[model samples]
Target chain A: MSSQAPETTQIHNIGYRSYDGPRLGRAYARRALFSQSLRGAYGLGRSAKSKVLPMLLFAVMCAPALIIVAISVYTKADKLFMEYTQYAVYLQLVIAVFLASQAPQSVSRDLRFRTVPLYFSRPIERVDYVLAKYGAMASALFVLTATPLVIMWIGSMLAKMDFAEQAKLFGQGLVSVAVLSVLFAGVGLVMAALTPRRGFGVAAVIAVLTISYGAVTTLQGISYTTENTGSIIWLGLFSPLTLVIGLQNAFLGAPASFPGEMQVGAGTGAVYLLVVLGLVAACYGILMRRYRKVGL
Target chain B: MIATESLSKRFPRVTALDRLSLDIGPGVTGLVGANGAGKSTMIKILLGLSPATEGSAQVLGLDVRTHGPEIRERVGYMPEHDCLPPDVSATEFVVHMARMSGLPATAARERTADTLRHVGLYEERYRPIGGYSTGMKQRVKLAQALVHDPKLVLLDEPTNGLDPVGRDEMLGLIRRVWTDFGISVLVTSHLLGELERTCDHVVVIDGGRLLRSSSTSDFTRTTTTLAVEVTDSDAHPDGAASLRAALAAAGVTIHAGVEDGLPGAGHVLLLEAPGEETYDLVRDTVAGLGLGLVRMEQRRHHIAEVFKATDQEEVPAR
Candidate 1:
C-alpha cells in the first residue's frame, strides 16, 4: 500500500484509528433505519416542539376510553360502557389526524431534504428504506389504534365483567386494529410520498381521509334512508375505516359499527379483505417506483 | 484500488461519461473536471449508487453491478451537494450514519466522536446543523463519510462552498484521511490548481471524455522558463524591461511574463534556461545593467497548463 509520496512525510497524530471490529452488514442497517423511523414517528428523537402534535392527538384518542372507565366504575355496572372493537370507529378522526401529522415525519423529511440518496448509497437497498418507513408507520398506527382497546379491556375487568367474554372481545378488537393499522399506514404513506412538502403532505393525507369517509357516510345515509339494501351494503367498500368494519362484522361476528341498516355478509367481507391487501401492495409498488426514479 | 474500463453513461439529453478508463492505486488521486463534466456522475457510478449504461467498473476489486453493497461497505462517499438534515446535531447524524454502515451502537457513537474531532468539530458538533456555518456543515458531511472507517473514501467536491482558509483546512483534512489512517482517497474538484498541491496523481476529464491522467509530479514537471524579477529604482523605472533587453542582447531567449499591474511595479522576465549556464548569464546580465535582482527561479508547470495546452490545440483545428 505504498503511495507515490515520500513515506517519511508523516501526518500529525490526531489519534486517527481504523476500525477492525466486525461489521454487521445489511440486515443491521435496515433494522437501524426502522428503529430511527419509528422513533421519529412520535418525535421521540426530535425536538420538543415536534413532540406536541402527536402526543396531543394520542391523549385525545385515549380520553373517551378513560371517561367511559370512570363512568363504569361509578355506576358499578356489570359490563364496560363501550364496545372494544367500536372504539376506533367512534374516534376515527383522532386516528386520522395522528396519521396525517406523523406520516410525514417518517417519510417526507428525507425526500424533501434530498437525504434519500445517502440512504441508498449505504449497504441497504432501496426496498429496505421503503419497507422500514412503511413498517414504522404501520407500527405507530397500530399502537394508536390499539391502546384505547386495552384500556377498555382493563376497565371491563375493573367493572367486574365476565373474564371470558371480555377477553374474547378484546382479541377481536386487536385483530380489527391490526387490520386498520395496515390499511391506514399504506394510504397515509402513499399520500406523504406524493408530495415532498410536509405541509402539503399533511393536508393531502387529512383531506383524503376526511373526504373519503365523509362521502361514503353521506352516500350510505342516503341509501339506508331510502332502504336501498344492495347499495348500502356495498358502499362501505369505498373508505378504509368502513372496509375494516365490514370485514370485522362479516368474519369476526363483531357488532356493526356501520351506519343505518347496512349489513356486511361473509362474501362481502371477503371482498373487503382482498381490497385492503391489494391497496397495501399497490402502495408499496408505487413507493418502489418513486424511489427508483430519484437519482443518486 | 479502483479500475474502470470504457465506462460510459448516457441520458436522453446528454452523455455524462464517455469511454473513460482509469487505474488508481493507493494514495490521494484527484479527479479534475468542470461542473457537469461527469465528475459527480463518475463518483456515483464508482460507489455503485448509479449504474453505468455501458461498460464495467470495479472498486476495491468488487464489481459495481453485482457487488454494490459489498463495495459500498468498504468505500465511503461524501456527495457534491448538500445532503444533511439541518435539524439534527452533527454527532447525532454521524452516529446514525455510522450505524447505517453496520457498526454496532457503541462502536457507532465512539467512532462518531473520534471522527468529528478529527474533522475539527468540537463543541459545535452538539449544535443543530441549521445554525452552523457552511464550513461546519461541510465538516459534518466529511465526518459522516469517514465515521464508518471504510478502506477507501470518494469525496465529491469537498471544498464546494468555502472561504480560502476553510478550503485549505478541508484539503488538509482530506490528506490526513490517507496519511493518518491509511485510507485511500479519490477526491474530485472542478478547480485543477488546488489538487496539484494535495494529490499524488491527477486525472482530467472534459465533455465526458478523458483529457489526461498522470502523476501530479509529471503533470507539473518543471518547464524551461526561468522567471526573473528585478527591483525598480528612479534610475531605471522599469528594471524588468532593462533586464529583458540586456538578456536578449546577450543572445538569450525571452518571453513576456504575466503582467500584474502598471509596468513600473517590477514585472517578471521569462528567460529560456536551456542549461545551468543560463542562470550565470542572467546573474552577469543583471550586474552589467546595474539592476537589483529581486528573484530568479525556474518556473514549474501548473496542472492548469494541461487544459491550456488542450484549448490551444482545439482552437486552431476548429
Candidate 2:
C-alpha cells in the first residue's frame, strides 16, 4: 500500500526572548482608566438607540421652556437680565430631576448585571473605572445642566439685551453651573457607591436631595419660629440645593433667605463653596476606595 | 502561559475558591468542575475581573492584580452567562467591542465582519441577538472574544445550554480558534468528556479546590485491564461465566463478567492483566475455547473515573 514513503520533518532552531523590568503599577492603572472610559463609550454606542431616545426626548421637552424664556427676554428687554437669572435657577431644578433619574441607573445597572467584572478585566484600574463612570454620567448630566444656561446666553445676545447685565449674569451662571455640576456628580457618585443595586442608589440619591433637605428645612423653619435665633444660619449648608441657593444669593447681591430673616453676606458664599468642596472631596475618596474593594 | 499560587476567594458564608495552585501552558487548557467549583472564579481572577482574597496569579507575564487590563487586552473573554444587550445586533455589538479594544473604526468593522463569518453567524448577525438561539448566541459571544484577535481567550462554559451536536460544533470551533488562528484558549466546562477530545491539557477541580491538573492523555490513558466480549452460541458454546472461569484457571484475574457492565451488554468479561499483551492473551484464550472472539480492547480510563477515584479517596478519609 505504501507506493511512496512519507518523509520525516526536521526541527529548526527556536528563538525566544524574555522581558524584565519594574512592575507596571501606576502605568497599568492609567491604561485601565483610559480603556474603561473607552468601554463606557463602547457600551453607550452599543446601546445608542436606547440612550439617544431618552436624550432626544429630554431635549424636545426642554425646547418649549427654552423658547418661552427667550420670548420673555425678547419682549421685556429691560428686565431681561433678572428674568434670565431666575430662569437659570428653575433650570437647575430640572437638572436635579434629570440627575436623580439617570445617574443612579448608570452606576447601578453595571452592578446589578454583574458586568463590573467586564470592566475590571480591562486595563482600567478601580479609580479609573469610577472616574470613567463619573465622566460618562457627568457628560449625560451636562446636557441638562449646561445646555439651558448656554441657550439663555445665546438667546440674550440675539435679543439685544443690555450687554453689561447680560455679561454679569452670564458670568454668575457659568460659575453656578460649574458648582452645580460638581455637586451633582459628587452626590450621584456617593449615592451609587453606597450600594450596588440600582433601586437603592436611586432612592438614596432622591432622599438625600429632596426628602432629607425638606425635613431639615422644615425643622429649621420651626426653630426660627420658636427660638427667634439666627444660629440656624448654617442649616442651608445641609442640602446641596440650599447651598447653591445661598451662594447664588450672595453672588447676585440678592437677599439671602434664612428661616426667619433675609440678609446678604459674602461670608456665607465662601462657606457654601467650602462645604461643596468638602462633600465632593469626601464623595470622591469614598467612591474610589469603595470601587477598589468592590468584588467585581 | 499562566500560573497561580495558593489562589483563594472567600464570600460571607462559602469560599468560592479554596487555596488552589496551578500552571497552564500553551495550547487548549480545559477547566472542568461542577457548578460552584470555582471554575468561573478562577477565570475571573485570571482575567482580573475579580481579585483573589489571597495568593497571586500571572497571565502572559502580567500580574492579575495590577495589570488586569493589560492582560485582558492581550487576552479575550467569553463570559458564561447571558450578558449580551438584547437590542444590539451581533455585528454592531462585536464591532463596538473591537473598537473599544483600541482598533480603528475601519479595522474594527472589518475584523467584526471577519470574526462573525468565522463563527458562522453570517446574515443572522444582523438580527438582534435577543431572538438568537443558544447556538447562535454562543457564536456571537465567541465572535466578540475573537474580534480583537487576542493572544489568549478565556471562554467560560462556551457550551452552556448547547445540545450534544451544538456542543461538538462549538468544541470544533474552539479547537480551530487555536489550531487555525494560533491563539491559546482557556475554556471551562462542567463535563470532562466534552473536553477530552478537544483540549491538550485538563485541570479538574471540585468543592472549590483543585483535584487534578494534567495532560488529557495522562487522565485518559488506558489501564492494564482488558474488556473482552465473546459470542455465545447454542452449539457446545460456554457463556461469559464459563469463559471467566477458564481465564481464571489460566492464571488470569477475571474481575467480572457480562453482568458487571464493562462494555457490551452480553458475554463481556472484565479481565485484569498484569502486562501489555492482555489483548493478545484474551484473543488466544477465547480462540482456544472455540468461542468466537467478538472484541478485546484495553479499558481506557474515562473522565468519570477521576470523580469515582476522588469519591473513593474521600470515603476512606472520612
Candidate 3:
C-alpha cells in the first residue's frame, strides 16, 4: 500500500482581515430570528398540546358557542346570536392565561438549562433571537385567543344576521383581539426576560396579570361605586385588561362613563394601546441587551 | 484555523478564562482542563456565543465577536450538557437542527441519516434521546453537530460520563470525524491521557490559564526510558530479577523494581537509557543470556506527570 499522508498539518500562515461588520451582524440576527421562529412553531404546534392542554380544552369547550350561534340563526334566537357579540370580551381572559403560561418559559428555559451558549454558537444574532421569541410568543397567543374569536365571528356571519350589525361586531372583534394579543404578548415577554428561572418567570407573569391587575380593578371598582369616575379611569390605565374592558363597556353603551362622565373616545383608547406597545418595545430592547451580555 | 490573543472572561464572582492565548491549526486539537478551568469559556468565545472581557479571538479568519453566525455556520458544537428536547427522537432532533442551520428539508434528512450512521447510531436514532444512555446521548449530540457538515467541531467533554469502553469508542469516533471526513475537531476532556492518545495537538489549561499548548508528540517526548521484559524460564524462577541484576551490572541505569510480566507474559524491568544505543545494548545483553526477549520498548513521559508538575508550581486563585 502507498504510504499514508502526514497525520498533522502546520497552522496556516495567513494575515487576518477584519470581519465584514454589517454583514456579520445581519447574518447573526437572521439566524437568531429563524431559530426563534422554528422554536415557536415546534413548541406551540407540537409540545404545547401536552403542556398547555387547558388552552386547547378551552377551544374545545367553545364549540357549544358555535352551535348556539347556529341554532340561533337557524331558528328563533337570531337576536340572542347578535347579542352574543358581547361575549368577545371573554377571549381577553383566555388570552391572558395563554400568554401568561407561555411567556415565562420562552427565554427563561434557555437561560435555566444553560442552552443559550448553543444558541449563540449558531449563525444567529442576539437581537434576532429576542425578536423571534417575541414574535413566536405573540403568534402562539394569537392562535389561542384570536383563532376562536375569528371562528365565532364566522359562525355569526353564517347564521345570516343583519349585515349592518354583523359589520359593526366584526370590526370590534378584530380590534379587540389585536389589542389584547399584543398586550398579553408584551407582558409575557417582559416577565420572562426579567428572570432566568422558569418558575420565577411564570410566577412573575401571574403576579402581574392576576394580583396586580386584580388590585387595580378592585380599587377602581370601589372608586366607581363611590361615583369617583376620575379615579376609575386612571386606575383602569394601570391594567391593560381593565382598560380594554372599560373601552368595551363604553363601546357597548354603558351609562356613567369611568373617566368622569367624559365619553370613552377612540383617541384615549388608542393612547392606551400606544402605551402598551411602548412598554412591549421597551421590554424587547431590555431583553435583547440582556441576552447579548449573557454568554451561553 | 483558530487563534486567540489573551482571551479572557470574567463572571460576576469568578474569572472563567484569564488571558489565554493559543493557536489551533487544522486537525484535532484537544483542550484538556478540569471542571471550571475555562475550557467551556474558550469554546463559547470561539463559537462567538460568549464574548471575552479582554483580548480577541478569531476562527476561520473571521472575528468571533461580530461574525459569530458566520463562525457558527462553519463550526459545529457538541455541548457539554444534556440539552435535547426530551420528546424528540435523535433523527427528528438532528434533522431539525440541520434545517435550522439552513439545510433544505430533503438535504437535512439525508445529512441527518448520514451523520447518525457515521456516529454509529443507526436504528437507535429513531428512539427519543431521553431514553438513551449517556453514551448514546453523547453520540446523538455529536451527530447533530456533524449533521450540518461544519468545517470544525467543538466537542465539550464528549466522553464526560462514559465507561472506559464507551470513552474509547467515543475517542475513536472523534478521530474518524477528522480522518474520514476531514473535519477538524476541538474536543475537550479533563483527562489529559485521553487527549494525548487521540489529539494531534494538546492544550492544557489550569484555573483559566494556559499551562501548556503543544503537539502531542512534543508533550510525550522526554529523556529515553526503556522497559525490557523477558519470558520466565522453568529454570529461572524470577526472570525479571535476573534481567534487572544483569542490566544493572552492565552499567545500565536501572530504575526501581523490575515489573512482573512482559507485554503479554513473563517479567519486565524498567531501565533508564542514556541514549538510543542503550536499546541495542539491552537487547544484546538479554539475548546474550539466551533468554526470550518478550518485549523491549522505550517509555515516554506520562501526561499525568506534566499535570503534576504544573500543579506543584502554583495554586490557582479560585
DockQ of each: 0.66, 0.18, 0.22
Docking verdict class for candidate 1: medium
Q: Name the runs in model 1 displaced over 4 angstroms.
A: A1-14, B232-237, B256-266, B314-318
Please state the error at residue B24 of candidate 1 in Å. Answer: 1.1
Please give the CA lDDT of all the candidate structures.
0.88, 0.73, 0.72
Give the top-scoring candidate (DockQ): 1
> Fraction of reference contacts reproduced per prediction?
0.72, 0.23, 0.27
lDDT of 2 by residue, A1-296 (tens): 57676587778533211112222333444443444343443244446554664565467536854786577566866544444344445555456556665665566656655555555555556776677667666555555555666777777777777778877777776676666667777897688767767677867787777775687678778778788556456777788777776777778644445666545368877887788789888878888877766544
Worst 10 residues of 1 chain A by lDDT: A253-262
- Could you tell me the lDDT of residue A168 within candidate 2? 78
| Candidate 3 or 1, higher TM-score | 1
State the TM-score of the second chain for every model.
0.94, 0.92, 0.88
Top candidate on lDDT is: 1
lDDT of 1 at A146: 91
Q: Candidate 3's residue-wise lDDT over B84-126, tens digit each?
A: 7655678977876765566666777777877887788978788
Give TM-scores for every candidate, taking all chains together and pairing residue i with residue i.
0.94, 0.80, 0.81
